[model samples]
Target: VVGAGPAGMTAAYYAALKGHAVTVFDMMEKQGGIARYGIPEYRLPKVKLDKELNSVWQLRDTEFKGGKMLGRDFSIDDLFTQGYDAVFLGLGAWRSNELRVPGEDLPGVIEAINYLRMNSEGNPVPVGKGQKVVVIGGGFTTFDCARTSRRLGADVTVVYRRSRKEMGAHYSEVDDAEHEGIRLEFFAAPVRFVEKNGRVGGVEFQRMALGEPDASGRRRPVPVEGSNFVIECDTAIPAIGQVPNLDFFEREQGVRKTKRETVITNGALMTDRPGVFAGGDVQMGARTVIECVAQGKLAAKAIDRYLAGDDMARVAEEIAEEEAVPELIDIVPYKPEEPQVRMPMLPFKERDLSFQLIENGYDKNAAEKEAARCLQCVCPDVGRCHLQRLSLEHGLTDNRFHRAEPVDYHDYEYDFSHDFILRDLNKCINCTQCVRICRDVIGANCYGLMGGGYDSIVTTPWNVSLKYTDCVSCGACAETCPTGALMMRERDLQTYELDIVRCIYCGDCVEVCPHGALGETPNFELSTYGRFGRTVLAKEELAVARTWKPSEEIPLDGHNSPRPPEIRPPGPPRWGD
Candidate 1:
């Protein structure tokens, strides 16, 4: 077994579990390759990584050796001669793509992968006296580089050849960078790097315009002649892309390559040579860590089949079936009414000079609240309510189970400020359905997790209310709310009514009420009104009623009386106040 990334590690674990004498080798000292190096600690913490790596370490018959470059230390022939029945090449793409420009070799120029790896390892690069830094690319790497520079006391700017909408990075990541004061210049292409005295100085760029849709369906960027401009900066980080290092395969053992220069593999990921297989970034190009894991597992199964001398045709069919099936859970049609739990962020000022983690992970309470918002898509309970089913199954009329610590509902003022839906923090259950729908489906970063712990609650940048935020009022959040918490405020009529009198202290109303309007109260005077017309009152109305009283009047008996009649002002309306 070779490589130590998620894919390689997973493959090694399974191979060992299956009783194969596995020996893993990697160039890095640690087991987690790109994940440990490329990703930021706040995004994928080392502790979580250690837990995963430790799981791999527990596999029997597995031996891990780090800091061993495959071709340099041993060749494919050496593995076959060592009595290993099969060899798996899981070497991942660790090389950074070059800009191929004039000043790319300047002293201050850097690659995204190296920068992230260094910083994640607590050995950050030194930025010279000048405060300006520029990043060129349009993906997650670009944002990571820019954000890292911002945290290192640089006034960072991102230069992309495409428009903001065309950015390939997660919208939330881009928004986070912007929130930290990272400037962006879109419709721009870097022409050449500007350097002085053997040091980086600035970048010359040309204005670009969107052209007709290319073969990829995206509008291609066309450089406008005579529109070149230069921006001065201390450093430039190019994060255009990354590719697999194929030198080991080529030099150590003559393995064939695809037209794109990746290793050529067979139906089961076996290279052109026998008893050798490859997978992960080296096979699928640079992709998500999850994808790498899936590939590694596939390679392991293939390796097992080869070792057992099973028919390759049968393995191909199985692999096809596995690839055809979707990985996401089939959730029921239930809407998620919970508000998104906010991820805590570092202050902008401090962000300029500190590499401190930005987002704080959710606590247990916050995790449970956020998890409750899941729609459980494709499950039988999709449209039907699971909480209701669970309550019925357990014969629970009241919430006798542990209650989550209460959040300060009043911190965020209810802004009837939007047309489609109302945002009332008091009613939100910390479900992230709205955030998911907006990001995954709509590709908009309008909403995101903010704050931390109990204080954490989803919000837009600058803490702008939904109306003032970039919300297009698409109603997706309302559509997926399991409880009526985030329902469309403009619905012709409110279909549900709260019967606080018969509520029996059951939180069904609270848990299912997405709007946060129906809340817990110490005063259950809802019993005062007749059972048929119990009403739900807004906090404001309740506050006003507390201060109301009848004006002074004389009694018909003769003397003025201080006491009022026992008759109560007719109880509140049935629907709501």
Candidate 2:
């Protein structure tokens, strides 16, 4: 892999996972590409980023060589000769696009990427305190330059030809920059840098208006007639965008690139040149980090297939099959609305003149809460479900209960009312474990055996939803179910408890529990003494209450005495009579 950006790192990880000898090389001293150097510390902290990247190093037979230039250190031909089977080119875009106006070559005109890179590396250039800095462009890089300059105590101003609504940068980031004291000027394009004594003193801009949609499907900016203006600034930074730096290699170097300078690849992520693969910003022409990661993953699979001498056609089909999005059913699961966790940050006053890393990542509690809200997007007890396992074991290809006539079978709607539990009537086997557990163990008597014999089923009382029941959403009934009838869904932080013996829904003491608040832990335990004075309550008893207890007076000579009274608490609230 060439370049250690998100794509390169992902490709290396997946390729190495498939038992391949992988080597990643980059020209920078650090492994991460733009994420480490181009992005500001406030957005992505290096420590967390490094911890993730360190995993790539831990992979067996995977090597990362920092400060190794592609053409200078070794060419593609050299890699083949060096006995490597294949090569991946994730060379990210490094060169900033030129502003192309007159006086742009003057001193104090900074290229956005290089300026941000320098600042990220702790090497301050011309920008400093009391300097009036004007940045050109309206994207992530533009805001990075403007905000970074503002952090350095420079009176920073951003000029964009398009409206703020049409900006390439995320709206939150643009708003953040505004909140950080960076001035914004829209509908203006840079004309030229105003020079004083051969150094930049200000910038001249032309007013623009929205024109017809361009090739990018966005409204093109048209220059307004005679609407030129000037803003005085000590420094000028043009952050238009960046393209892949392909200076070392030529057009006829076997690999091919589009007119926009992005490498054109086959469906399998392979360049025109055999055994050489390209992905990330170099191939996609400066896209988001997530997009780069997907391309990287795709390229890794393609490279693996190519190395194994598999047919490219089959490989393309398999790649497409994997990448194809699964068709979602129209029934959207109604998940409770929860606000996203806001990342903590330093106050605006503290941010000035200090790059002391901004975003304080989520602590354990915050992370757990945030993670519990994942919708799971999947069933928690999928593999371990005894019902699913038994069905597979018995070769249950078709449901014998699903009758041809609609009236022959009851199609009861799903009960998603309970916050942390999902009740699917189709999967219920009428074992009465949920009814018994809810009444006996949890005391949240939310369920009962309902209806006549032929049409009988277990559900919330009066068949009128669980919201009206005494269910606390403790997930005890769910944890006790023998099948997928009652499933404990994800619920962060909001938890309930149960005891063993009477809680026959589960044969074990501790269950994985719902998603959010906590994992299923034995918060409710009943300690009992055996014949030899050993606490023998075990895992199965962990889920139930003691149905049979020892007598108050201990009979020493192994006499199996009469059973003690069943200690029962008041049952869960009653909704119906």
Candidate 3:
């Protein structure tokens, strides 16, 4: 592995897991490349980063050689000669783009990447403490510099050529910088540096107007005629995008690279040379940390397959299919309104010269509450739901007792009534949270175990509508439900248009209503009335509901709350050993 960024570490991890002898070499002194040096301390602390990187160090037979750069210390052929089986190049995009404007070579004018890197180390750059700094560009790096300057007691201003919406930086970062008294001037592109006495004074900017969409699909910023302006300051920092630095890549090695300097690779991440693979920002230009990690992992797979003599093309196709965009399932889940748990941050008043971390990540309770609010749209409880997690942990992906026929899977209709809860029986994994919470916590005893064997399920007594039971509408059951089985409905009545053709006007719904949702109105008609909710009952549905007679075992103890019968397990698996 080369360049110990997120991608390199991830590749090293996967390679180590496969029992491969791995050695990570980086030009930097530390394991985390950008995550350690590039990002500011206030954003990502050194201790936390070190802790994460230490995991790779714990692996047996894996070695880390800091300051061992490619092309200088050793070449691709050199590694191959050293008995190494495979090489993964995770050289990240480190080299920041130059402004290419006049006076850019001035002393005070700096690149934000270098500034952040210097600050991250004990060595601080001289652009703070009574200095008026104007940062050019609007990206994470730009905000980082502006905010860092603010903390360093610099009167900072961020100038971008497009609207705030068009900025490449996250809105949260931009908002935080603005809140920290960092001025933001939009529709202004850096024209040149306003030199004063040779060193630097301020930056001259050109006012811009948005034009047709560029290749990126965002409106391109066009320079406005005669709209020249200058912001007087002591320093000018350009925090534009970065590109991969291939200074170490020798042409004699035969690895191809794009004009952007990103390494060109096949679908399997292999370069032109055999056994030479590249991934992360070095391959996919400048991307997110997660994307880099993903690239590293995929590259590891390709390397493993290559080593195992598998067809590279077939492996690439399978990987592409696995990583294909997931089909969008248009399933809307109802959830109660709850504000996100806010993470505590360092007070703005105390954010001067101190590199103390800003965000104090969510606590246990805060994390749990925030996690519980997830709609669990995909598998409902992907991260938070213990059932889903445990299923994955136990490797439940391939069930032991596979359904032999199409009739094995149960399909049940949904119940959207009861005002406060939604019941989608299809998603219920039978975790029994609802059964426990309703019976033990709420004491409403609305639900009980019904059916037998593999078909066992929790439902209201006799599978009656939740409103028919003594439900308090406290939403305890929905809250306790692990999956998207029972979700708390949005606090609104679902309007059901009355089909007059299907209405028999039998008034059975009005008679059997528990919440008094149906009753005589001022008009003295059998239409849906009262405040509980308006449910326009179809004559056919009413007929089926009317036929649902009370079982002899059911008792009228406030509700037809029938106690569940003793579960008698029928024998072991019929076919399994």
Instruction: Give the range where candidate 1 is weakest over 10 consecutive residues by summed lDDT.
Output: 566-575
Computed on alpha carbons, the lDDT of every model, listed in order, comes to: 0.73, 0.78, 0.78
Across 1-577, the per-residue lDDT of candidate 3 in tens digits comes to 9889999998987676555679999998889988887888888888999888776665546799998888788888788889998889999988899989998999898888788888887796887688899998888888988998888889999999999998899998998888788999999988888879988898888999999999999999999999998899998889898999997676437798888999988888988887888999999988888899988988887998889889887877766654453543433446777888999888877777777898988877787888888765644434345444456669987666646777887778899987778998888777786876566544567898899888888888999988777777756677556677888875524375767666645454554343355685544333222123334444444334434333534323224555322111233212221
Cα deviation in Å at residue 274, candidate 3? 2.4
Q: Which 10 consecutive positions of candidate 3 have the poorest summed lDDT?
A: 565-574
lDDT of 2 by residue, 115-213 (tens): 989988989678889989999989999888898898888999999999999999999889888888999999999888888987998999999999999
lDDT of 1 by residue, 1-577 (tens): 8889888998887665455768888988888988888887656778888887876564445688999877888888888898888888777777889878788888888888888888887884855334898999989888878887776778888999999998999998888788888899999998889987788889999999999999879999999999999989888889998888776555656567765547777768888787888888888788888998988877887998899899776777766654554433444445635569886666666666665667767776787778778653422223345465556668997856434545533445776778777766655556776676566544445777887676667666667767765565556666655555566774534366756455533233443332344576775332222234433444345444344455644223224434433223444222222
Per-model TM-score, in order, reads 0.62, 0.66, 0.65
Which is superior by lDDT, 1 or 2?
A: 2
Q: Sort every candidate by TM-score, greatest first.
A: 2, 3, 1
Which of the numbered candidates is closest to the native, going by highest TM-score?
2
- Per-residue error for 68 in candidate 1, Å, reads 0.8
TM-score of candidate 1 versus the correct structure, residues matched by position: 0.62
